[model samples]
Target chain A: MEIYRYSMYPLGLKKLIVPCRQLQAFLQDLLESTDHLKAVLVTDKDGVILAKATGPDLPDHVLEPAFSATFSVASDQSGKLGFGRNKMIMSTFDEDQVVQFNYSPLILTLLASSKANSGVLIAAGKDLEEPIKIVGESVSKAIQHEHKAKEYV
Target chain B: MLKPKVITQVLQQANTAGVHAALLLNPDGSLVSFAGGTEKDAKVLAAVASNVWFGYERYGKPPAANSVEGGEGKEGLRNLILDCEQGKLSITRTSRMLLCLVADERVEWGLLKAKTRTLKEYLEGPLNLVASY
Candidate 1:
């Protein structure tokens, strides 16, 4: 029975869950720390929103697909620029600022007020290193599980 | 209306400010003028700048909410900075064209921003002239 359970858990039972709650919680904490921040979004390369946290003034749907489009397009073109992989992109507008990070297999976008200190926001993004690592590992494991399961069937 | 002399002046100022290379490009990423960098890198920068600007315009800006008074989304894009492993790429929008700069690790972010502001001001007239042409 123990061996059977081990075979069933080939993908590692510990890492199977996507850790959606942890990501949401981290984003929520990040949002609360700064009023200047409007929203935080985590998405895959395909523009699928995996986790998000928004301020009271901003609605969840406010982001739509525009944020994803911005990051995806920039990242794709960035590679051709021969600067190696892009680390971060910061764009400032009239009233808002958008910062996108190339987390590989995942893209992290932060929407903030134009008035916010960009240095602080960039530091906040750097703080996500640990969480991003965990999330990346879990997501990779989930994908591996799906593939392995398909092979079994 | 635009003169090669004006582009040279701006590029010279940028080089003095510690930028390794710079390129002046149209919104579509066509090279208007280039200084310091290899031709291949300049072309790539122009293409990337255009794509990034297009993406920001089309998707990055959200629609203004009906209830959100005084909120507008039609404002012109100010600039874009991409921090990469190789170095930093800063693209600023002038009245008509894009100014792209590639700086090495020796350049500080604050210093770069300050220089970029001045470069943008210097390039505005010439870039606008290019647009008019």
Candidate 2:
């Protein structure tokens, strides 16, 4: 599948909500706070990368869609196990760890070294709750505006 | 093969420290030993852990990236933590087995992880013995 890379101005939301540049800055700040973090991605529910920041140590093949989609499925399935809603999923490998937050309408993913503290990353994801909700709401409004504009044409 | 008494002891030890249940399973999801839960619950957890692990392997694969050399890169998931409304679920790999801890809301993340790390270390020895057998 061909993935579409959007500019800092995404979804005709250029002037409507938080600009993509600001979103990128937010992600960059997260990357800078952690020493072992390699990359951070902010993607919509469909796995479209809205903003991203990368450190020098990132691997060549960090597929944005894979992380987004995997979290979606994993979280959805796991929720039915009587645990109620799934808030976060953290996977650790030998050399790397992936942490994803189940922020609806938006998924925040972090790529970090295996040695990085999971608790810190979990706290970071919690801290993102409000900002992500605001961004999600703004984008939804912008999308509604776009649909309305198309109807007149 | 691990003696039943040793497996029971391992599960018993894990039952402390706010861990409500503990399970030891093969990589294939077959339950080997379990504690603090019914047999049916153990089976269900084993299946869930296997499915979640497979989901990560199938969908979390990086695109066109070479495997990590001489590492367990091909071994799929090493550890997974699921934070939910009621509690936390931690699954860690040990040798060729998987150690799963089901903790209630009272369990803190640090305490749970520390318990998991210690259990993983302890399991390694018996697991190697089983492998040798």
Candidate 3:
């Protein structure tokens, strides 16, 4: 299929939110495909971790709380550059290249080794770009779903 | 507190070599010293780059950018070269400080890389002393 979709019901909400099973699965597939991938983190605009995958060799400490807070600060502060909105930030390290893709309220981080195919890594994110946007919308639906459930209860 | 003169010296040297700006930043994205660009611009760069650095440093051993060989070791991070659309930004480190260089589009990357190492060595002595205190 050219397009993929999956359904998720956030907590108590009856209305199915944006299809994220595919996103989560895709994230997993991404981790599995890249041998040197350290981790993958998906965060809301506030830097809340929605989902994550830890690679074979890397420790979870790499995605510690500090990273979320840093993302929050960066999103809040980076808008002033007058460059519209920063869609992504790529930082090159001697050992690896860290790429963060911004899909509005959601950000996807891919950690790959320096030896890994840069083009392939970039493609992974590009292929999922639309899915990330769907993830963001789903998160909002989940939030509203919780709110509605609270009101009814 | 870092001696501010170190930044001026770095800027002077970088400027002579045709680099646009030079600055020192803490890993936490705090500004230590900057030689070029507006204050706001430098601060933003510090914040973003440090966030990237913070995430990258904790991934265990970084591969030595041994060109394309991707040699592995747990040396943390040694340097970063960001070749952006407009220009290039290079970061090298002392034991306790991060040196950032914003190069013009036509700047000599090889010389800038070498200069960054020298700057790191220069800052290491004073920064390490403070670290021990």
Candidate 4:
């Protein structure tokens, strides 16, 4: 089974692959160290999935839109309810299941089981704050590069 | 204590900072006060409130049903604050009214939040008091 699943992108987004790969590596390490069973990086604002890491139980396509919709809801709630700009959202469906997002241009989302350490997972998600910021900036740069390249072509 | 003054202040702060638009809506989502840098139709405010209410009905309630397990108080309230760049809209809630701030791509959310925080505190206190009388 494919552990990672993604859709084809136009050449404009092809430039983002390098940074996306780096983000995938960082997320893989983060997920492996913690008990986070699934991880996805989505483009902030747009809700496009850039990369993901999941176990065999979950498929990439299934998780991609799930992350996008969750982020969309969170972002929507933040806008309508007055939570300020949504910097992060951590929600527990039950004692065993939790979903989290750190909002940069790239959002780091995690799914963890009940046995996982909630506090640790929260902190680990927060820990990715800087890296996520870096990833967003790099992706923005890549997009710019792609745009410029297109202009030349 | 004057409603117009408060509305002016909210709009001015939002405008000076280059925000797109800011307005105050009643709990039911009627436009009680408004200040927009650009002209907007009165119908837009009503539509926004209706949209928020629709969202509240959809995703805002079910989570509360499970609130007895420590899930209720603010989850619904939090859901009311929704953002949609696709829609070019942002809204915040207070005890008495929903504050809707609309902007295009140029708005900086950080600054908008700070301004809204100030406004929220002000509205909750003196503004609420005025509304009561």
Predicted complex 3: CAPRI docking category: incorrect
Report the C-alpha displacement of residue A21, candidate 1, in angstroms: 1.3
Candidate ranking under DockQ, highest first, comes to 1, 2, 3, 4
In candidate 4, position A56 carries an lDDT of: 54
Model 1 misplacement above 4 A = A1-18, B65-74
Model 4: residues with Cα > 4 Å off, grouped in runs: A1-16, A40-44, A80-83, A94-98, A149-153, B1-133
**Model 1 Cα lDDT, one tens digit per residue, B37-125:** 78887887788788887787766775543334334555556878888777788888877788888887567777777777888997776
State, as a TM-score between 0 and 1, how close model 1 is to the true structure: 0.87
Taken over the whole model, the C-alpha lDDT of each candidate is 0.77, 0.77, 0.65, 0.55
Candidate 2 lDDT, B1-133, residue by residue in tens: 5687777777788787678898888878899888887888789878888778778876764432345533334435577888888878888888778889999867887788778889999889868876653
**Clashes (N, CA, C under 3 Å) per candidate:** 1, 0, 1, 20
User: What residue pairs clash in candidate 1, if any at all?
Assistant: A66-B59
DockQ of each: 0.59, 0.48, 0.16, 0.05
lDDT of 2 at A106: 83
Give a tens-digit lDDT track for model 4, residues A17-132: 67678877877787777764554454565556676666655534334234445555545555543324554443333333334454656666666654576557667777777767
> What ranking of all candidate models by TM-score puts the best one first?
1, 2, 3, 4
DockQ of 2: 0.48
Compute the interface RMSD for candidate 4: 9.1
Q: Which of the two candidates, 2 or 3, achieves a greater DockQ against the reference?
A: 2
